[model samples]
Target: MLESWRWYGPYDNIALSEVRHTGASGIVTALHEVPYGDVWTRDAIADRRQEIERAGLKWVMVESLPIHERIKRDDGDLSQLFANYRQSMANLAEQGVNAICYNFMPLLDWTRTDLTAPTRYGGTCLRFEATRMAAFEIHMLEREEAAEDYPADVLEGAKAWFEASGEEERNTLLASIMSGLPGAFDRYDIAGLRKALALYDGIGREQLRVHYKRFLEEVVPAAEDLGVRLCVHPDDPPRDILGLPRIVSNADDIAWIMGAVDSRANGLTLCSGSLGANPANDVPAIARQFGDRIHFAHLRNVAKDADGSFEEAEHLDGDTDMVDLVRALLEEEARRKQEGRADSNIVFRPDHGHEMLMDAERQNPPGYPLIGRMKGLAELRGVIRALA
Candidate 1:
């Protein structure tokens, strides 16, 4: 595996020089300044690549070039959006960046209720509480028929949670759910978010699957032509939220999407944290099964509870078996090498690290504090070296 780190470009609290010191040879990033549905010009790609190269890091993967809402909803002029997407793929390929990671979750990207949940080691980690999310949906955003989405007991739990939360807690929960995260281009207020949810009002899992297949149909060929691998990231939290369907969650979902395009160019990002959030998803098994199709990897662990709550845990100390997972990745790499594939060495980054050390003092993005990720990378590096 080629160790990599995600950089949010020039404005990131952590600089390129800081990333280089982590001993990661590659940088996984995107042209975040470019808006969704807009073409990423070759000039911009070149400039970004130049910047990373100057820091002695190679730009190995585009973390995302977001698929526009217009395209996801099949609303508006999709042809123009598809054209822009194709152009971005071409631009990335032209700059020798092949692996592109993206997600198709509607309304919100990856979400967490608490960005400062306390860890055993006095660090802070991102956390998701199902009851809190339900509270936000039913009592906060007040989405139509939101009560039907949760179990009877869970609904009562959510109601209790909502009633207990004061003004500050409510505001914080609202911001965490509606406001965008680092690299997320969209943000919405309460009314705006409600309006956004209304658009997907009737769209369920089947319809969302259709839209995803249509997305693959439009972009896979272009990706193949440009020699770029389009890796679709799993739905964060790996379940339905805010009354929206989450199409890409489990192994079957991955199989369905991979079968839609049936090309090497159409692939998976294989995010362990997202997939592992649902205990049903066997992280190592998924890694072994889809090893060939995995284009990029986000390796982090989470400690999941029976009540559908989870917190990001130390890299090697959660539900995911880091040893077996890394071993599986190595086996996949060996297979690719034997098959003479050009992208044999997978580019993986330590996904979400706890907020600890000096990182806790800085105004770093949640899950993206510099010292925390460095600790994760160091641990991962040790595992890879030991296994190799």
Candidate 2:
């Protein structure tokens, strides 16, 4: 396995010099400055690669190339957008970066309820609570459809929580729940969120899956031609919220997805934290089952309660058996080697670490603090070394 770290680029606050000392030689990043539907020009890709190389690190995988909403919804001038997407892939491959990661979560990405839930260890971790999220939809966003999506008991609890939470608390919840991943929702507000959600009013699970399948069909050939691995990241909570459908959540979902396009280039990111967020998903089992299809991985763990709530836990101490999961991935690597596969070794990064140590003071893009991730990578490194 090739150890990697995810960097949000120049403004990530943690310097490249600091990144070099973290024991990760490769970086997982994207040209987030580029607009979603526009083509990532070869010059832009080359420039990004140059920046990483100058830092004494290789640009390994694109955490997201970001599939445009038009492509996902099957609307607008999609032919051009799809062409742009392929061009972006070609541009990256031209620059020697092969692996690309993306998520199919419509409109919003990786929604969490709490950005700073205090831990007993004195550090803070990103948290997701069902009631708080329900409250966000029912009260804050004021979506008429969301009321039907959640259960009666859940609705009651969410309503009560909404009534009890103060103005500041409500505002915090609004920001956290609506703040789509790193670059997607920086300036987003409630009106913006509702507008995005309205676009997918009638699109259900099956239709969304159809869109995803078409995406694979159109994009996989380009990836295969370029010797690139295009991996789909799992939904963060791995469940439906705000009436949005999730097609890539569990083992069956993965099976369906991998079945859509049969090629090594069409692959999975295999995020343990995302997969483990759903109690039904056995993380190690998924790794073992889809090991051949996994091109890149995000290694992290989560502590899940009975009520479908979870928070980030130390890499090694969570519902997921980290050592066993790593062992499974390593075994897969050995299998690839035995088969004489060229794209055998996988690049993996420690994801969503607790905001601990010196990181507690600085402002980080929730769950991506410097010290926390370094600690996680160090712990993961120890496991890999011991197993090897």
Candidate 3:
């Protein structure tokens, strides 16, 4: 596996010079400035590549070229959107960046009810409390039949939380879930949320799967033609939170996705933190099973609670056996080498580190604190070096 770091473009607090100090040769990033549905011009991609190269880092993977919501929902008549997306892929591959990491998650991207959950070490880690999230969905967002989505204990817990929360707290919860974390994607207020959710009103899991497969059928061919690997990231938390459909969550989902398009270009990101949030997902086993198709990896762990709560754990400390997972990925790389495959080394980043030490004062995006991720990268590096 090749070590990499995710750098939010020019305005990111951790500069390219600092990324070098993290001991990662590869940088995973995207042109976040380019608005939704807009083409990432070849010139823009080149300029970004030049910047990373100038700092002695290679832009290994486009962390995402975000899919438009209109494209995801398939409101019919998507010729232009598909054309633009294909153009973006062509532009990226032409710029010598072939690996693209993206997700088909609707509405929100990795929702968390609490941004600053306290850790035992006096640092903060990202967390999702089931009851608090339920409260937001039931009492705050007020989605019709949202209460039916939760069990009796969760609904009762949500009631208690909702009644006790002040207006400010309620508003914070709304922003965290709806805003798509500011730098990630578009922001949605209550009206915007309702409008977006309404788009998927009649679309359940099956219909959503239809739209997803349709998307792959169109885009995967373009990706293959462009010599680009499009890796679909697993659904964060591996479940539907806001009543949206889930297509890529478990091993079965991965098998279906791989078979859907059935091309080497159609790959998986293999985000451990996201997939490991669900207890049933055996992280190491999945890595071994789908080893060849995994083009990218997000290596982080989480401590799970019985009530669907998950707190970000240190790189090797969570429920998933980080060592065994790394071993599996290494074994795949070794196999690829023996087979003389071109994509032998998978690109991986230390994902979603806790806000530790001076990170509290740094105020980088939640789960993206420099010191925390530096620590995570170092720990993961130690694992790789020892195993390899």
Candidate 4:
């Protein structure tokens, strides 16, 4: 597992110098300034790669080259959108970026109702409070047929939570919920969001899954030819949010996806925090089963609650068995080495860190506080060293 940090391009307050001091030698980044449905031109890709090289960090993976809403909905001049996608991959390949990490979750990328929940550790951490989320769906956003998804008790809890929350708290919650993950979908306004939702009104979970397969069918062959591995990231929180479908949730979904494309280039990003949000998902088992096709990894853990809510825990503190997971990767890496695969680079980053210490004052992105991620990288580094 190559130790890496996710950088949100040049504008991020966390500089490359800061990243270097944190003991990470690789970077997981993207052309974030580039808009969706456009090509990341060859010159632009080369410039970014050169910038990373100058910082003494290898550009290991692209966090994403975002798939546009039009592509997801199978609409809006897809021929041109797909052509741009192919051209982007070609650009990345030329720049030596082999693994591209992306997701197919419709509309929002990940949702969490609370930005700063009191952790048992006496510091603030990111959380997914169910009640606050319902307040948005049932009373605020008010999507059609939203109530059918929750139980009676859950609905009541949401009401109570909404009634108790102040305007500031509610605003904080909404901001946190809509803050898209790095390189994932953008936040949507009520009208803009509704328009995006309308495109998928008749499309069920199965149809969305098929649409994703079609995307890979069109995209992966080019990826294979260019030696670029297209790594589909799992749905964050691993469930449906805001009446939208999450296709890459569990092992079966991933298996179905791989079966759909049946190509080495179409692979999984293997995010522990995302999959661990669902207690039913056995992360270690999935690692073993699909280890061969796992081109990228986002290693972090989550503490899941019984009512289908969760919070970001320390890298090793969550429900996922870090020991078992790391060991499995070690075994897989050894096998790949024995098989003589040239590009055996498994780009792993410490996903979703706690906001703590000096980072308390810094405007670090949610779940990406510097100190917490530094600690996580050190812990993961130790594990990798011991395995080696």
Ranking by TM-score: 3, 1, 2, 4
> What lDDT score belongs to each candidate, Candidate 1 first?
0.88, 0.89, 0.89, 0.85
Q: What would the TM-score be for candidate 2 when compared with the true structure?
A: 0.97
lDDT of 1 by residue, 224-262 (tens): 888899899999889888888998999999999999989
Each prediction's TM-score versus the true structure: 0.97, 0.97, 0.97, 0.96
Q: In terms of TM-score, which candidate is stronger, 1 or 4?
A: 1
lDDT of 2 at 195: 78
Cα lDDT tens digits for candidate 4, 1-388? 6889999886567989889998889999899888888999989999988988999999999988889887788875688888899999998998788789989988777788777788776667888877677777887677868788777777899888878879887667767877863343466665676776787888789888878877998899999999988989999878888888888999999999999989889899999999999989999999999999998889998898877779988888899998889988888888999999875657799987887778778787778888888988888888888877
Model 3 clash count equals 0
Ten-residue region with minimum lDDT total, candidate 3: 176-185
* Regions more than 4 Å wrong, model 2: 151-153, 181-186
lDDT of 2 by residue, 346-366 (tens): 889999899888896778677
Give per-candidate clash totals: 0, 0, 0, 0
lDDT of 1 at 171: 88
